[model samples]
Target: MNRKDKIALERYRKRLEFARSSGEVNAFETKAEQKARIERAKKDYAYMCKEYFPHYATSEPADCHLKAAKQTMKNPTIKKFDEMPRGFGKSVMDDILIPFWLWINDQAHYMVLVTVSKDRASELLEDLRAEFEGNPKIIHDFGEQHGHGQWEKGFFITKSGFVAKALGAGQSVRGLRVKSRRPDYIVVDDLETKELIKNPKRQDEYVKWIERDLIPTMDGDIRRFVYANNRFAPVMIQTKLQEKHPEWVVNHIKAYDPVTYKPTWHQKYHDNYYRELEKDIGTLALEAEYLQNPQVEGYYFKPEHIQYGKMPKLNQFKIIIGTWDVAYAGSATSDYNAIDVKGLHDKNFWVIDTFVKRCKMVTAVSYMCDFQKRLPKTVVVHWRFEAQFWNDEVERVIRETERQYGIKLNILKIQVPKIKKMDRILTLHPYYQNGRIFYNEKLKSHNDTQVGIAQLLSIEPNYKTNDDYPDTQQTGIALLEPYNTQNDGLNYRQGKMRPKNERI
Candidate 1:
């Protein structure tokens, strides 16, 4: 069938179904019933939205949040932010529907839509053009448009004197004007990317532009701003904007209902559907994308979010080493002496064993000696410790422990610079995100491992707790990096200096 025939059939089916459900024909409808429907549509923004764009909205909920958004946008002094998950019609609402509605109602005459790239911004404008040209519902309600000659890719001028323009981030938006009108509303959509946020300097630059350039382009104090994005990172531009200006009203719509693990909008993304996606992408990525939790905060070590499973056998490991974060006295309040037996098999970084203690120096040395003696006979375990924390007395104890244990400890004293503790722990965060870190299942039972897990989960900037486990794990991972590129399996080479130095 042709498109027109199909549309006719679909409408006929809907009408017939409605008649059967209500036990009444539309031809016999009461005047009161028709009046109520008309009055309700006039009052409801979501109702009006669907009435205008019925084809784009299927399984329409009672509330699509357009009503609330419209009310919020009515207050010009209120800067608005809506963080909706992917595929939730964020662009349709912010880039097209809200702006178009505001324009037709004479709420605003000039609007700007900014995105990550100029091409994306232009495409958003093209959507508006398509709607204006061909949307029968809009044309029937608002009359035919007379802006055909003025419509273009990046900017358009409606015959009613409403102007819409598209611009990318970092582009010059100063003194933006069309005739005597300046932008009355600005809609920023996903202006951040992983690449853009990676550099601290670049992030600051973007923020400066948003504050110094974008906001100032408005004609008066009664300008409305709408920012739409998913919660990609805690340091994202929207997050920063909210921090600087606490008055901004922010709304975050998560894809899934956290308690039920079901999709919030089941018609689009169902529970079982996203559970499969969660499995494929892993929990960390899924949480960031759908749950609106990036698992990144001030303290970067997220041990709770780290992927863990049964580790391979000791023999299967290509490299195994016990790396240390040493303390001198190990007093009750002093830093705990810590060591982690770490190994690498395939792409997985494994923490096979952990030892952390608040005891005398001799006791700490004994734990290290015992850890060396317990390793597999076939495994040539390399030993590394912070040399700055050791002295002639500690070195003498290590030599005697080797003689007594009859095990040659391939020990290396790494003189690492005094870096800030928090910075050191965060170096492992990327590996955790990539699902590369695993811990021995039994390690959870040990107090030191428990301490490590606690620190990992609760870590933040200016972390107050002892981070012995995370610090030692960092050392162990650093030692394993050299072998990460080699193909001939675990090669025992001299340990190199750690890559990043912490600020003292």
Candidate 2:
């Protein structure tokens, strides 16, 4: 045997050894049983996957998403894009499970996996290589897969005319074919990166390559195209494809409900898992990666507009007011209970404290009571919330909170004018633009403070982004306009009329 044959023999030996020892192959099934099982699995993809990969399909019964994805792959003529979130077993599903299914079903003659880089794709291809080289159950069912003993890292050909190749993004796609067949199954996994999304020219070029070059390499009428990646950026390849091919099947499954935090794949993951993950990575990252709803950096309220400094003493301010934006449903799908405590001094609006969260009205009310208790009773803070949100439930919540805390809250209602919400939000544009708004430098790293700022910067004219934090912020600052001058004492009230000067 040649040196290449010797190497192939050695690789196969090690792979088979691992597979047998690792419970990846069945040692008990007779030939008839294996044949019957494979034949039954030829139609039941999920069963086939579970039986073949008991360790991977360990959710007792697999999640609906896994079953659904398998059904999608079963279609020979499928053209689909899946914006699957992280931790959803995307790599394993596309690289190993689907490829094996296609090869066993004779649906693919030549398969191609195009990832961010050649090396990464080659590394991913190893999983499939191990399955083909060693899986005893597969070998018993369909015979040996190592065809012609030509197993290379870049591409591999099995004994049963199955061909699999790996390539990098923007790689040359001039000649991709088997002896007489073109690629029948193509998987494009994570071709966009953070830096790549920032460069529109490169993004455009990559899309062109996929459309004008790579995809056209498929020759058969019966084929499948799966682009599996989260749409974490505005100009990513997956986003472009989704816009261009609205007719294609799109499975944009998120890890959990962004509002309720209920796990989508509950069989595999739990609610606390997503909550803990969000805490570790922060809300913005959770939205971008696991939710696939990335927030673009502020266009109107740029980062430069945000200023932070050491705040003056609470008593030194001309006026300190608190604004509350009440929300009925305390989920991200609805408005949050956004409250911003603002103090106007020297014509600058300083964010002293913030309470932004998606919780029940009682929780926000309790927070107000707690904050009131923490402050010096000598320094009074007049609080106001929109009159439109005032209802029996709101009143009951306030009364209950007051009773529970055994203290009265100095709060009132502010009639929101009949103007557009966005119009009202734009009231703070001048302050932000003129560098008259300052965040408490000490509280800059606070989660509530950061979330409020993120929402402020993400505001757009007509787009429905989260505006709860900024809504309350503008309301508080706008209310403190008359108090910009330091003539009023610390006792100035919200609706207290100014004492008219009398002729002496």
Candidate 3:
């Protein structure tokens, strides 16, 4: 309110404005100046290291990778270095490169550190804390601050002006945006797990989260994304990014012989494990785990390999036939049968629809009656019941439904011979392999069907999953064998009458 107080306030405001306008007020220089400063700083720092910790610094002087990592930190363009494998100075690079770079360049604003899990992220922060505290030179370069866990924060008030903060990767990391300053640098240390990377859906989610949530918060111009992890799958962040964004520079630091560049250690370990693994499991198991290749095992069938045939439209293949693999009484040991419907064509078979039920026979018959109402008048949909324990029940329901609806439902009883599992698999292999079989893309049993087919096709009989439905599928294919041929002519004897005593 006084004139003297107002004058003092006005002077203070003018000085603040002057400081803001004059870029020279702070030592933060241009990119070219910063580069020159970084080079000089690195040379002085390396010399200081040699003088202070001669033994510790020169232990791995012969290693080109270690020297390269140190050099890479000096260059502004190379923001990340993906150090692969264990005992290859990964932790050392993290401890040294980031802190050293921040210490030397005062203009560096914020540093965001990330790891795969919360526990590992915490551990990395602790390691960084120790390095900063133990090294007095680091303290001199960067001012020290103490806090606990997530609350922990530090800064380096260099002549230029730079600050670094250690953080983890999780939902907790979402708080990185709260900072007044944007990150000039980011160091992501092994932010992927074996299970998370392998799964396609999980990998997609993580990648989107990183791009949407993490990347936007940083200073895009000076930002860095450092990552290191054991090779997982083709769907991993590194692999996916390299494919999706080809312009981004990516380097793979692998361990191999200098001359031959062969994976000696990796191969040796794989060879030893595979020798034992092959004896218990098979070659597919070895290839999947050790070689990191896709393996089709314990799968009901290989759906990826299923061929979609070029055939006439659904209206043309009007003659439909439904076959039921039935089970009733809700017994734990019972098979949940599938009623597979095929639309017979002049040349190829069209799997128009299917009905799978594991309940009372009356319930199943009612379902079939409902299905018949929706079908075309020209479409003569025939029902084939497995002439076994529940044949009489199916017959009774079919007769009642036909009488009620006035639709002449032709029910045929076919005898499914009792055969070994391997024999049944072998019988169905030729039909599938020769491309005589086709299934709807919308089939819920698509995966199961493929796995079943794979089991049948394997040289050694290895039926691991539930064999009931797949086995029933095999029997149905066998009964239809007489109907399958290159010639359009149907076998009169095969199509004449259904077999009796259908026993599995």
Winner by lDDT? 2
Error of 3 at 368 (Å): 65
Show model 2 residue runs off by greater than 4 Å. 1-26, 43-46, 58-64, 259-262, 486-504
Q: On TM-score, who's better, 1 or 2?
A: 2
Top candidate when judged by TM-score against the true structure: 2
Q: By the lDDT metric, which is better: model 1 or model 3? A: 1
lDDT of 2 by residue, 1-504 (tens): 999768756865675565544354558768788778888777776787777766566664336456556756567778887778887877778877777776677776788999989988876676777777777667767788877666877689888878889999889987686668898888988888888888888887887888888888887776788888877875577777767878878887778776678888887787788889877888777777887867677877888888999999888787788899998887656678898998888767789999888778888888889988888856777889999899999999999999999888868999877888788887777677766789889876777777788788878756666899988998887788876674334212222324445222
Cα RMSD, each candidate: 13.5, 6.1, 22.3
Off by over 4 Å in 3: 1-41, 44-58, 61-83, 137-179, 258-504
Error of 1 at 328 (Å): 39
* Residue-level lDDT tens digits of model 1 in 1-504: 999768645654553343223122255557787566555555566675666656555556424466445655568655888888776887777877677666655677788989988778876666666666556555544566648667766787766677888899999986578767899889898888887767778888888899999988886755988898888775778888888989788887777654346677776666687768765775556656876756443355554555557879998988998887777765435676778888989866898887776655566667767876776787667888887767888788778877877766767888665887677677777677655678888765555665556556657765555678778888889888767764334332212222233222
The TM-scores, one per candidate, come to 0.57, 0.85, 0.41
TM-score of 1: 0.57
Name the lDDT value of residue 445 in candidate 3. Answer: 38
Clashing residue pairs in all predictions, respectively, total 1, 1, 13
Model 3 Cα lDDT, one tens digit per residue, 8-119: 4565455334323312212555767655544665665554344323333544222434454554555543434453544345555554444554455543456666666654
